[model samples]
Target chain A: MSLLQQLRLGFRSLMLHKLRSALAVLGILIGVTAVIWLVAMGEGVSYQAQQQIKDLGATSIIIRSIKPSEESSRDVGSRFGISYGLLRDDYERIVTNVPTISRAVPMREISREVRHREYAIDGQAIGCTPDYFGMNRLTIARGRAISEVDMKGYANVVVLAWEAARKLFPIEDPLGRAVQIGTEFYVVVGIAAERTAAAAIGGSLDARQYDRDVYIPLSTFRARIGDRVFTLRAGTTQLETVELTQITAVVEDMKEVDATADIIRSLLQRYHKSVDYAVVVPKELLEQAETMRAMFNVLLLLIAGISLLVGGIGIMNIMLATVTERTREIGIRRALGATKGEIVRQFLCETVVLAGTGGLLGVAFGFLCGPTVNGVRMAVGAFLPEVWSALPPNIRNLEPRLAPWSIIAAFAISVGVGILFGIYPARRAASMDPIEALRHE
Target chain B: MNELQPTVDREIVASIVGVSKVYKLGGHTVRALDNVSIDFRQGDFVAIMGSSGSGKSTLLNLLGCLDRPDSGQYILAGRDVAAMDDETLSRIRGRYLGFIFQSYNLIQQLSVVENIEVPLSYQRPPLPGGRERCLKLAELVGLSGRLGHRPTELSGGQQQRVAIARALVNNPHVILADEPTGNLDTATSHEIMDLLDALNRAGRTIVMVTHENDIAERARRIVRLRDGRIDTISEVRPALPVVSGSIALERL
Candidate 1:
């Protein structure tokens, strides 16, 4: 028989038991939809992580001074206090010694209260050079940033972050206005633009917020605030002095990041007595993110494959029952001169119809993943405010990104599952004896 | 015995020579057909009659190429079909034989016209003008108005008429009917028999298996079997009369 006629025959036969056939299709539909939706969500999450890493500038390396453990600090403690961290001399050494280092910026930050006309807010006071603003991707909203002249002259000038600028001078523009920090009044040279927070990358890099910072020239910070600071701990006064908090170095070539970081680490290891500094490369984090995305996709596919396996089993079950139920029909066709191959083709056609239909419909639903997630997110936010608030920021702001390959793979796998599970039942139908099948009532 | 002789004047369409079929039923050997031989000529209408297990059904099955004989040769249209493979046997059946069942074995999902077209669909290289042939046959069987109606919607007589039309669609060398009227009322049975009689008169070769002597009397010859052997072969009716401008069976 022609293939079209066989398919029509199969379709008519399946229509005989409508509910049974629809349930079989539903099994495959759920499997395909699960694969697509899960992959899209996974892609979205990984895409977000990769974007954050990319934002950190691939050629830049960050070195942060970590507080050493108590035992290490006690070993290095002097009569004044424990003093262990990146110093100004280390920054000069890295800049002068590393040939690949194109530029470097040194920064020191401390939490302090800045006040203007009885308005006070706790903010991070950052001492940095002109290169720091460009390296950190910070933009100026008003006036000019701290200049080379300010650093050379040790001028007492500061740049208020967007939120700090808004709070310290609620109604008036804060440009050229003086704000007090630790008994020193510094003029606000500029206001930094608002920036969204960057997510933390493993344990190596901390999440950064720019809105609560007040930037000042490093020369002026050292000349005015000095390096020594005292704090009361357990009713006893302790003194600590630190020259630098962070050093960000930029390389001319991306290929030199890893080698340059290694050289810097060993150089610091030779000078520092304890492990008190961390070197982070955005390129390494980007590679790690790529690996994470691959693993996540594989894991998602595995889970979705299990569901499709169950769906395939359901198809086999339905086809088996269909074969048993239509023994007499097989006999009739055989008597009418249908060969064994024809019988097999007929049954196989029915299964392909079932799975192909489910696959197309599942792909159609896959395209709706982004909208569906958004709808559910909005519904939760509107109906269950408390629950929505409890969700992590990742889930709350998730944007599902459909991967084209996943859609293609899901549809192809579903059709493949149909054929894989269909062979046995079709063979069973073909092998039935015509004489016996004719006798089957 | 003379009546059993093959007539040299007419063309023989099918013949079985020294054919025997054995079956194993619950480990006991049952000889369904034992050393049976018969010749069927063109335009022949033969009825086979016997009691239960008398081998009439077995003889019909063997003649229809649905079963292989244990020994001897069965030839149809000059081909030795007894030892043919399953696929070739099926092709032979499609090319040279048609079947009508007692229960009107019409596929439930198909309409009357599609039911008639089923055998044609199985024809290798497929017959051209199949749908037109199906429509013409349906009209010949007086079912043109019910062409699109399923078997379940038709009366028993109407369903049997559709079966008869299906049997003619392939233009087979032989038409095999297994108790074609067993499930019909007397009036419906006569209606079906009339349709079969008209088709036979139009030069179609028909082989019918029935228990009713009255049904057998309608055929030109009757073969009776007892205990897996032929007991009698009788001429019941004269030769078919030449009819003018009747329904021409098209070679689809």
Candidate 2:
């Protein structure tokens, strides 16, 4: 028989039991939807992580000073006011000795109270060169950031972070206004824009919040603070001296980040006797992120495949029942001169049609991932404000990213499952004895 | 019987020699047909009648190519078909034979026209003008007006008419009817028999199996089976001149 004719026959048979056919289609629909929805969510998460790593500067290496252990502190704290950290000389050496490093920005920060006419807040007083602003993706909202002339001339100018500006100068113009930091007065030159905090990436890096910070020239900081500060405790006084807290070395090319980071680490190990610093390469983290995304997608696909397998089993069960129900019809067709292969083809066609229809519907719904996720979040926010507020910021702001391959792969697998599961039942129907089938009641 | 060959004349449409079919019901073997032989010529209307389990149905099944004999040589249209495989049997059935069942065996989901097209769809070197041919057969079987109706929507006699149209749609060499009137009322049975009689008179060979003697009498020859063997073969004479005159008036 012509394939078209067999398909027509198969369609009519499936239509004879509309409820059963619809149920089989529903099984496949759920499976395909799960595959698309789960993969989209996974892609969204991986994309968010990779973006955070990229924001940290994919072609840069960061060296941060950490407190040494008690045994190592004995060698460093023997002389009072002799602190251990990234030195100013070390930054100069990295810039001059390392040919791969295109630029190096040194920064030092200390927690201090700032006062602007009785509106006082505790904020970090930061000293950095001009390249620090662009390297950290910090934008200036008003006036201008720390200029190279300001650092070279040792100008006493400062910039207020977004939250600090709001706290200290709520309704007043703060730019060019005087703010006192630990008995020293500095002029506010600019205000930094608000930025979302980046999440911590592994144990090597800590979470960074860019708001509520004060910026000034590194030359001015050394001249004013003098690299010596004494804190009065409950009974005794502690004196500490630290020149630079961190140094960020940017490479001309992304491929040279690992080589530069290794050279910097060896340089620090030779200059500092105690282990008080860590070198972090963002390039390595980016590679790890890519590998993790691949593994995550495969795991999600396997889980989705299991659901589709269950859906295929449902199709096989229904097909087997349909064959039993239509034994007499099969006998009639055989008597009308249908071959065994034609009978098998007829049943297989019905299953493929069921799966194909379900797959098309699933792809249509898959595109709704973004809107659906947002709608659900809005509903939760409206009904359960407390629960919504408790969710992590990442979850609150998640945007589902639909991967095109998931749509194609899920659709192909569903149809393939239909054919694979259809074989046994179709064979059973084809192998039935004509006399016995005709006698079936 | 083993050495029997085809005769020079090609008028014989089918011949069977020493065909036996054995069925094993659980552990016990039942001989459905035992050493039976028969011959049917072209343009002949024959009926084989018997009681239950008398092997009439078995003989019809073998002749229809729905099954094979345990041991025999059966020839149809100058071809040995007893040992043919399924694919060959299906092609032979589609090309050279048609069937009409007692229950009207029409597919419930299909309209009368689609059911009529069923056999033609199986023909290789596919027949063109299928819809036109189906419509013509529907007119021939007096079901042209009911071509779009499903089997369930038709009466028993109308359904049987649709079955007859389907049987003739492929224009096969012979039509096999198993108790064609077994499920119809007497008036409907007579109407169906009249249709068959007209078809036979129009030079189409037919083989029918019926238990009723009156029904068997409609055919030109009646072969009776008893205990899995042919008991007697009888040739029914034509009707008297009065009946012939009535038939002639009816034809007018």
Which candidate comes out best when scored by lDDT? 1
Q: Please state the CAPRI-style docking class of candidate 1.
A: medium
Q: Native contacts recovered by candidate 2, as a share? A: 0.55
**How much is A193 displaced in model 1, in angstroms?**
4.2
List the global CA lDDT of all models. Answer: 0.88, 0.85
Grade the docking of candidate 2: medium
TM-score of each candidate?
Answer: 0.92, 0.88
Model 2's DockQ score: 0.59
Candidate 1 displacement at residue A95 in angstroms: 1.6
Instruction: After the best TM-score superposition of candidate 2, give how far the Cα of residue B222 lies from its true spot, in angstroms.
Output: 1.4
- Please state the i-RMS of candidate 1: 0.9
| lDDT (C-alpha) at residue B48 in model 2 | 91
User: Residue A343 error for model 2, in Å?
Assistant: 1.2
DockQ of candidates 1 onward, in order?
0.74, 0.59
Q: How well is each residue in B1-252 modelled by candidate 2, as lDDT tens digits? A: 211223233256788888999999999998889999887665568889989999999999999999999998889889989999998888888888889999888988899999998888788878778899888888888888888899999999999999898888777777899999999999999999999888777656789999988889998778889988988877774311122222332221
lDDT per residue for candidate 1 within A168-244, as digits (tens), equals: 99998898899998688999989999976665642534457678899999999888877777877899998877888
Cα-based lDDT at residue B12, candidate 1: 75
